[model samples]
Target: MLDNLPLLLNGFSLAVSPYNIMLMMVGVFLGILVGVLPGLGAPNGVTLLMPLTFGMNPVSAIILLTSMYWGALYGGSTTSILFNIPGEPSSVATTFDGHPMAKAGRATEALTTAFVASGFGALFGVVVVTILSSWATRFALRFSPVEYFSVFMLAFGSFVAFGGGSPIKALVSLGLGFSWASIGMDTVSGSMRLTYGFNELSRGINLLVVVIGLYGIAELCQTMQASPGTVQPVATRLSPREVLRAVLAMPRYWIALLRSACIGVWMGITPGGPTAATFMSYGVGRRFSKAGARFGTGEPQGLVSSETADQAAGSAAMLPMLALGLPSSATAAVLLGGLMIWGLTPGPALFAERPDFVWGLIASMYVSNAVCVIMALTTVPLFAAVLRAPFNITGPLIVIVCLVGAWTVGSNRTDIAMVLAFGAVGYFMSRLDYPVAPLVLAMVLGDRTEDAFRQSMILAKGSIWIFWSNPLAGTIITVALLCFALPGFTALWRLARRQFLPPPVASGR
Candidate 1:
């Protein structure tokens, strides 16, 4: 970690250039707009902008996207506090206390607390990434095809076990992603696999097109269906004095802040995603804080707990994506796709081959966090006004953007139709309560998973036992199996306990 300081410094020099800084500001502003608007979150915003990055340098493209993400996160809190709406799904927990505080005329305090806490959490997560990424990359250097396969299984298993959704639904999503990924010619054999002689599918489905459909178009449809008339934002003025007061008072809740940040880091690394991290941190805060009883009644700590965890998890998730080719969230999955599009492979080799890119991205996170905090605090009113735009106007515009983005991917008309098809699929999947992140992750990693498994099989002469041929591979596979089985085991245990335990006698009212 100490040895990497020089690289980090060099990264700062690269990130702080005039061009990069301009991009950062622009990305953050657009991201805030995306977050403030109904139906557009960080993932959707990033997906929408991906096409524009095709002509950009890979490093610049990544910095722009990541800065947008941080800004979107901060923007989400604005709506949660002022409009009783969560602009981003991860900000849902913020609404509990944030809205109440706004209603009580503490909007400025709630907004300030949320942004500052989020900044702190993001910085904490970035620090952890800086220290852990090098070690993780080194550890991954020892992995072979068998180990890689096991690692992929572990990622899939962890998603199923801890994804905070139904295991069957998650598995089904994975299957769908893998099926879509298999569409087109096989790279190793140079033979068609899933294309049913459709000339359009010979090149396979584009990841960008799918993402535009799933996140952009699909979300617009849902938003239109669930339009809630005009939003009346809370009236509040943020003064420098109030901002300073909120920042100073944050130290009082240091324990909660630290605890939530740690939870965010752990969840981000393990694929629980920021949405889960926020709720988990909020729940834990409510359970343990002395003001637990007042949690939903305008407690400032509630905002801190949820907002901090949301940003922390978001920042920490980059580690797995960069070091091990594992994306812990939907946005990370999209970024992984961007890396591949730029001819960059994510893994230990990436660090060795392109330390500049890796460290530059890491350093940019620090700079972006500070930029987001300042932007969010100063521009709350501007973003709040944006929410007043009717969905009828914004909805159609979003659809056009999605279509245009899809069309540009290969200038193929078929891509537009595919986007519509996937849009329907995504909408229905959301209605059925199916998790989309797992599917997205699977799609991004599916081809690699298959290649690794095939290589492992070849090495073992078609023996299935090859996964367990060595201690490292065996251990990883074992852990993956345990992760996959954990939910079932817990359910069975609960069922057994319910059947065997005696019921308590009813008390008289």
Candidate 2:
């Protein structure tokens, strides 16, 4: 680590140059906009801007793109907090506690905690990239189909067990999501499964459309039904004292912050990416925190866990893309393409040939994290002001934004209609006390999980024991099984004890 100081300094010098700094700032601002608004996400934002980087130096182009990535991660929380809508799939975890905090008139606190935690997580990811790139890349490559499948199962099992709802209901929601995900053409055989003879259905439902309809339009419908007349505003201003206090409180949750960062980094290096990291961290944090029982009900710990992991994974994803020529997430894949377009080869070879480029990208991440935090904090008043407006006025704006977001994907009108349908489904699910998180999460992981399981089975020549053939895969599978079984075991134990225990004496009566 000590031997890399001069290279680090050179990287920092390049990142801090006037042109690069300005580019970083612009990227952050646009990224935040894209993140807060519906439809456009980090991948879309980066791809839209990729053409503009054609004539620029690779270092400058990457700094701008990566900064935008960080900014979008930060910006996603804004909409999740202010409204029930999550601008990105990862931000869905943020909505578990963030919007409730907003409704409780603690929007300022929620936003502050999310932004600060995101900065810490992103900075940690960047530092880890600089110091452990080689080792981490190698470690990530060790995850095979069985291990990946076990991990995905663990994620689903965790939600079913500790999602603070009826386990049966969670399972039902999970199954529903999987069913919805199966609507597209089959990847293995190229045969359509549930398209129902419609050409649009053959293409399958887009997750972004589902998210926008379920959260945005469905939320508006609920608001309209709940408060038929005048819509009131919540408090949105934060005092300087409050700001300092929130900043000071950061140390109290350092353990959660650090744990979330680690989880994020792991997911970022592997195939799970930021969305999975946020959900997994949030679920684990809920089970571990003493305030676990209050998760999804305006708990600050949930916000911290979700936002921290979300940003951390976003940053860590760059490591595998740059060091291994592997894209860990959708956004990273777009960046990977950009890297190729610039006549630069990714992987270990890039490091040997262009040390300055690699290190410069690493150093610039540090600067971007700082810049994003500052920009988000300073703009708190502006976002909070949106919460000040009456729901009637802001409601339509959100709907319009949701429509715009839906229109951006393939310019398909069918998607807009699907959004409305899912909005209705979401509203009914809420009314029925079903956990939407599981549904959304399962939808996100369904295709990947199925593919992994099938691939594992094929590799094992149809043997079911392949999941347990390797020690690593076996251990993870065992843990995942235990997570699901613990609840049932406890219930049975209580029933047996009740049956064996003697009746109470008359004195008890």
Candidate 3:
């Protein structure tokens, strides 16, 4: 790590150039706009900018794309906090407490906490990448199909065990998500399994469309149902002072911050992705925090956990993309393609050959993230003001935004209808006390998990022992099993105490 210091310093010098700094600002602003709008997430935003980068230098192009990515991440939390909509899939967990906090008239604090925590997580991830680039490349190479499957299972198990809801309900949600994920043609068989003769279903449901309906449209439905007429604005005070206070209070949750950053880094390096990292971190934080019981009720720790994990995973993902030619997240995948388009190859050789480019990108991460925090902070008042708008106006605007966003996903009208249908499902699910997090998690990762499992099985020739044949895979599977059984074990322990141990005696005196 120390040997790379001079290179890192050189990278910083390159990143801080006036031209690169201007690109960072432009990328961040555009990214924030994309993130604030539902469905136009980081992946889409990066893809949209690819064509424009052809004329730019590789370093400049990457700086623009990565800076935009960081901005979008911060921007996504904006809508999640002020409204119940998640601008990005990863921001879903942020909505759990962020929206509630906004409803309680603490929008400024929620936004501040989210942006700051995200910045911290991103910096932490960059530090990890700086220190562990070579080590991470070697570690990532050891993962086989079996290990990948184990990792996915661990994510699901964490949700079931640590998610503060009925395990049965979480399972049911997971089942639905997996079922939805399986709708498209099977890759191996090339057979349509769930289309039911509908040509539109052949393409499969777009996850973004589903998310728009489930969170954006669903929230709209709930809002309209709860209040028929114009609803009064939520009382909120947005100021630099409030933001400062939130920043100052962050140290109190250092435990959550560190734990979530670790989870994010692990998930990023291991293919769990930013979306999964956010949900898993939220679940783990809920289970471990002193105020665990209050997680969903406007808890700052929940926001911190989810946001921190999200940025951490996103940043750490760059390591694998740069070192191993593996993109852990969709945005990273797009960026990887951009690298190829620029006539650069990924892997260990690229690092040695293009130390300036590699280290410059790393240094840009630090500079851009710091810039993003400041830029996002300055925009809080503007975003928070949206909450002060009467529901009569904002309600229609939100619905329009949801429909528009859904329509853009595939340029198919079918997605708009799907969003509406999912909206109804989301509304009813919320009324029924079902957790949406598991469903989203399943949908995002379900297809990949299935593919890994199938590949593992094929390699094993139908034997189940492949998962245990290696120490790493075996340990991961074992941990997953423990997570899966934790809730049941807790229930049994409580039951045993009720049956054998005496209740607290009434102390009359």
The most accurate candidate by TM-score is 1
lDDT of 1 at 379: 96
Model 1 global lDDT (CA atoms, 0 to 1): 0.89
Q: In model 3, what is the error at residue 240, expressed in angstroms?
A: 7.4
Q: Which one is best on lDDT?
A: 1
Q: Report the C-alpha lDDT of model 1 over 3-67, residue by residue, as the tens digit.
A: 78998998899888999999999999988888887767787788778878979998899999999
Candidate 1 lDDT at 72 equals: 88
Model 1 TM-score, 2 decimals: 0.96
Ranking by TM-score: 1, 3, 2
Give the backbone clash total of model 3.
0
> Candidate 3 residues 1-509, lDDT tens each?
68778888999998889999999999998788768754356765675566578688999999999999999999899878876767787999999999999898888899899999999999999999998875655665677879878877886787787666787787898899899989988877899979999999999887767767776677566667774543333444578788889999999999999999999999888756798899999999999989778999999999999999999999999997887565666577668767876899777777778988899999999999999999988876665564445667766766776677666656898988998899889888877878776777677667768988999999999999999999999998999889889989999999999889877985577
Can you tell me which runs of candidate 3 are displaced by over 4 Å? 2-118, 225-364, 502-509
Local error of candidate 2 at 283, Å? Answer: 12
lDDT of 2 at 108: 78
Ranking of all candidate structures by their lDDT, best first: 1, 3, 2
State, as a TM-score between 0 and 1, how close model 3 is to the true structure: 0.68
| Residue 170 local lDDT, model 2 | 80
